[model samples]
Target: MTESLDDTALDRLFRTARTRNGWTDRPVAEALLRQVYDLAKMGPTSANVSPARFVFVASAAAKARLAPHLSNTNRPKALAAPVCAIVAFDLDFAQRIPELFPNNPGAQAWFADPKVAEVTAFRNGSLQGAYLMLAARALGLDCGPMSGFSQSGLDAEFFAGTSWRSNFLCSLGYGSDENLFPRNPRLAFEDACRVL
Candidate 1:
């Protein structure tokens, strides 16, 4: 049986983790980015339809391309961070089911409908995005995840002619306390969950 994570690990991953609103000048390396993906990819998804695709905006030119797509409130956060990751979902994810779920040869047929494929891709991709954030935090990086951008604009700018569709953006780097707001309260377990 797997052992429970210690309190320190839990605190780092969830309890005390904050949504970074400001960033320092530290640069996130390519190797670290690869490591983050490697860990996040291990998270489970339905039928193993791993549809999430990440575009790391690390270079000045790429950040420039991303800036216009962000809202005014989010622009500075994205620009200030060392990397802004565009988390996307691939519409053609089902095509790879034969490779991803070899034991279930018929799994690919389940997503033949456009609607089913779209929903599965989006739902699983969002799960992967959350895994990505957790992995980043595990690697000692802070995250500022946002959905304030125009989806059509981001898709047009970053995913034209591709099956990938933008889901959200996450800025990654060392966080600064400059713009941090007081931590808000979460719903109690009884309020948000049930044993039945």
Candidate 2:
């Protein structure tokens, strides 16, 4: 087994993560995408339900299919990015919860109700999506996460026959400094945190 690593690299990765708007006209290889998934899948989820699924739209035809689903504000950036990921959640995630949460009996039953399924799908999918962004950043890729797309349109166009449902869209590529928005001010740590 390999020795444990230090935390400095993780801290730097988080600190340096930026929401990129402009991208270089370079392709993100499938190998890199696989590596990103390998890292992201390690993140913890409720009962390890692991609902998030990704569809990497890199072909011209796929991009064309995705274009119509994006909002006017996001279309340009979406088209420019090397890869656009359709982040989704499987409706039947509970079926695999037993394997994911082997230590806990009846864990899968927690999401058996219709209302619980909806809640778990969105919540765990969102968490996994965030892990994806961090993983991409760690792999030296820039990300533009957007929610401006028409989710219903995406579902109809790309996920019509699948159990997967759209959660959000993320564009990944090599970013350019030319088109970045000015960094906005953030709440101070004290103001944003509360210790009980």
Candidate 3:
């Protein structure tokens, strides 16, 4: 049986972790980015559909391409961040099911309908994005995840002619604690969950 994570691990991953609003000048190395993805990819998804794609905007030219599409509030953070990742989803991810789930060749047929594909891609993709954030934090990086952006423009500029579409944006770097706001309260377990 698997053991529960210790207090320090829990705190590092959730209890005391804060969303980054700004970052220090420290850079996020490419190797670390690869490591982050390697860990996050292991997180489970329905039928292993694994639709999420990420674009690490580490260069000024790439960040410039993304800036105009972000909301005013997100623009400065995106610019200030060492890397702004575009967390996207593939609208045609089901095509890979035969490879990812070879034991169940019939699984690909489940998402043949556009509606089912949409829902499954979205649901699994969003989960992958969350896993990415957790993996980043575990690797000692910080994250600022945002959804206030022009999705169409991002998709048009960054994912043009590709099946990938924007889901959200995440800025990654070493956070400046001086830039953090007061921690917000979360719903109590009883208020947000149930044993039944």
Output the number of the lDDT-best candidate.
1
Estimate the lDDT of model 3. 0.93
Q: In model 2, state the lDDT of residue 131.
A: 94
Q: What are the per-model C-alpha RMSD values against the true structure?
A: 0.8, 2.6, 0.9
Whichever of 1 and 3 has more TM-score, that candidate is 1
Runs in model 2 with CA error above 4 Å?
Answer: 1-12
Off by over 4 Å in 1: none
lDDT of 1: 0.94
Model 3 stretches astray by more than 4 angstroms: none
Rank all candidate structures by their TM-score, best first, as comma-separated numbers: 1, 3, 2
Clashing pairs in 2: none
Per-residue lDDT for 182 in model 1?
A: 95
Residue pairs with colliding backbones in model 3 are none
TM-score of each model, paired residue for residue? 0.98, 0.91, 0.97
lDDT measured at residue 25 in model 2 versus the true structure, 0 to 100: 95
lDDT, residue 170, model 2: 93
Q: Candidate 2 versus the native: TM-score?
A: 0.91
- What does candidate 1 score on TM? 0.98
